[model samples]
Target chain A: MTEEGQSEIFQKMWSRKGFRAELRAASAIAIKQWKVELSYPLSVLWFIIMPFIWFIPYLIAGTALTGSSESIHLQDLTGISDWLSYIAIGTAFTGLALSLLWGSGFALRREQNVGTLETLMTTPMNRETLVWGSTLHNLQHGGLGVILQLGASVLIFGVSLNVWGILPALAIIGLSIIAMQGVIFAVVCIVLTAKQGWMIVEFLSSILMLVAPMTYPIAVLPPILQYVSVASPLTWTVEGFRGFLMYGLAYEGVITAVIALIILDVIFVIVGTLLFRATERLVRQRGALSQF
Target chain B: MTETIQEPSTKSVESDMAYLTDFKPRIMDWSAARVFATKNLKIAIRYPANFLVWGVLPILWFAPFILMATAIAGPSTSTHFTNISGFDDFVQFSVIGWFVFMYLDNSIWGIGNNFRWEQFSGTLEPLFTAPVPRISILLGAAFSDSIQGTLQAIIMLIFAMFLFGVEYAITAIFPTVLILLIMVFALYGFGFMVAGLILVFKDPSVLTQLIAESTYMLSPIQYPVQALPKSVQAIAYVIPTTIGIITVREIAINGTMSLPAFVQSIGALGFLALIFWGLGMLSFKWAEKWTKERGHMGGF
Candidate 1:
């Protein structure tokens, strides 16, 4: 509480070495959470199993449904006979989006409920580091779900892919998740004030699922809904992944989607950080952080 | 001699024990089933935002798709699609089908996962302590969601009527309403089953998503079920939504429901409703027991 101690804290905040230390600390925390999530076998099974079950039947049905039609083909949509691959990608991205939103958004509330939020905050680790660590933890948890679903799509549906293009598709997926995390963090700020984060979670999960271009293409959506889909990062990620993996990277649209994702990520991070900082200050002054 | 030795204090204590033994739960409160239903209704009205998100939002969501499909397929396409069900306008078919499915999905997923919100809000355990059965709590939540879904569906149907310029026939109104009622109960039974899973698993997101996404493919929403392969068609008949969608479409577009079709569709839905409702109740009871034993009724 003394001036000398405050000065030391300020000094620690500013140094290059201190910044690196914070990043390392955040990474460690993120990794630890990811490990804990991996320990849940049922969670892993649910993520992978359900998508395969749904998508495989659809793939088989799709072939029969479209057998007479010449316009849409396996080669035309995603270079796979199994429409399950397309559905698989949609399912995977959805899992990722849901995880990012729920995981990071709920982290603080969970910690607070467990009576650990204050203790964690009291530690010397910077708030930014904690936020980053939580976001990373979410990404890893969600990313694993997506990967498992994708793998199941391949195995069960017999859907073949270029395989090499998966890396870029993953990068795009990561960026999309990061962008979504920003929006979720802002919502978390509102949640902190209202103490209605769970309602927000319910609303977001159900609403977003309908609005986003997850199950069907944007083409299936009306003009207005199409715009709504475009506004969501998940739509672009779905389209971009479809373009890169299914279309053999021939579509120039993937570039635009990737660029959009990057911009969204940067904007979201800045906005999330600002909202978090403002909320943190309000909580500190009002002593509301521990209220829940 | 013993009777003569009895004190007033002992007599009072004996009376108190008799009072405790004779006490019975009031008949009105014994069931308390409506409490769960009422609680859900109250929550829905109290939180209009949740209603809008789960109920009204789906209408908004499918609005765009409906408009474009109508624009591309033309108003007459309804006649073509309806020949299967007998309704003349495809828009009417879509309006009824989408709204019904939307409500069903919202109620099922909403009630199933209601615990997550309660868990996060730190109210799950306190709620469990109440004498009211947990089923009532879930039913209350489901009722709220269903009301929202119903309202949204009505509004969407009205909007579609105006937007697509489809005429409503009074003759078919009774059938349509009847079908809606059947769909509602059938879906509720299924929703409760999903809710039961949530009780057991603590997270129903995965199961909910699998069912939700797959339903769109299985149901005859955008296209006729006959468009699906024979194998897939067999599977589709097993799902209540398929019959629900077809029945709604039949009344909306075809203007007549055949005896055989009605019997088959209603029978299929009745069977499914019975199965899901039984499973849901059983699972819920098991979950209640498990939670009590494990002390995780409160913990997320």
Candidate 2:
């Protein structure tokens, strides 16, 4: 056999080994982050306790105030008698939206700050596997807090899952979250390029929560601002969740939401991946990885 | 002989005068404060892209809500608050409330997170070692945050007005601005306390998500405080942002403010500000002492 042909075969053999090594390293990093989160049980507790604290007042207030009013009209337009259920769903989804943003956007920065980014990069690990591992770790750690909060919602708000196809609604919400991974990735890239730490991301995430229709429906927003909310993933997620939980998941609107989720996920992931790869190269050239 | 004796006394008096001049300005250390603030400001603005991302992104953040609101409720539709005191216009109410919130969140987080970045850049120790007081360093950071936040709020308000067709009364603008300023300072004081905690705990990010989520829920950003139950309303009354939101709503929408409400709002804000400032200063001093003792002043 020719030397060139033999070398090509050897390269292919090494690539397989490299891929396996990368996968292992990424998993290790993800587990490490998860362990760190578990170490702080109080943080998890706060996440659980906060939602209950927020919703109880609304539940009590709704019951008391709506008693005098005709038919428990909590909102101006919509006649939602079950204000607890309405706010409970809103709060749950809002918590979910927050978990996605915080988990993905700051996950990379956290690893980088802890001096793990360079270690992982130097290994035979591929960036995609590392991202997946980090994302998975984020889901596990953040998911624990979210589940705890959900449990609190059930306990405090007395939320009853009566709607059919609730699981599919949750599945859609999960997909929408996964799609938001792209935006989170984009935010991480910006964080890397700016190197100003996580304050910018923190501010952006909070502002997004307020601007998005997480608590109140978009019917409450004015004309132009309503158009703006449509651009956010949170709106789709919230609307999709509410549509399924409140109005039986049989609406055609769910299809539009599913399609939009897929499109947004593809767009965000592709663009975010490209931006991240380019930023990684820039960081490498600047030798910033070691410095941080 | 008398003239010759007068010369020494005159020379002594001149030296004393010079000494007093030097001591007088130390009363405030305004120059040191300015330099400290300017350095941080330059760092924040050094990266134009970052400045735009941090400073201008909040406006874009409002875009999604704008789209959703318009889609659900047509542009011509107005939101009415029957339970609240004087906020008939939903768009205007949301705009002002969000503006205040955006400003508070920016300034508070900016001040609180300054230490983490300083640690990353290997500058925290030097900053701590500087002759200027720690308060000056914090004040400088807070000032930069205020500048960025104020600019963002103005841009956001303009976008909200034009996009939402929000009508504003100039007469109410001044009082609204006053309430906003009080709320900002009061909130910044709370932010300083958190920043102090960051210095001591070394894990401020742990509280970041919790703080961010709770404040928004607690504040009356989109809805009226009265919409909340009596228990929640009591809690909201204690929160500085509630006062700010209610005052702004009353002035801008109703074109009137009850004297009792105005006094209550200002009084609550003032009390909170004083409490936060006192606690923040104490915590800051303790953190400084602890860091210096442990020799971790420079260690990020």
Q: Total clashing residue pairs per candidate?
A: 12, 21
Task: Note the chain A TM-score of all models in turn.
Answer: 0.80, 0.80
The deviation in Å at residue B102 for candidate 1 is 4.1
lDDT of 2 by residue, B175-239 (tens): 88788878778877777877776777666665765676567666776556766667877877656
TM-score of 2: 0.73
The candidates' DockQ values read 0.15, 0.13
Which tens-of-lDDT digit does each residue in B17-38 have in candidate 1? 9977886644234235566566
Q: RMSD of candidate 1 to the true fold?
A: 7.3
> For residues A6-113, what per-residue lDDT tens digits would candidate 1 score against the true structure?
999888755635767888877887987767666877556665565455444334333333332122433343333444455557666765677667777777777787
Tens digit per residue, CA lDDT, model 2, A78-165: 5444545655676666655666676666666776777777886765556666666767666665556556655676675466654585
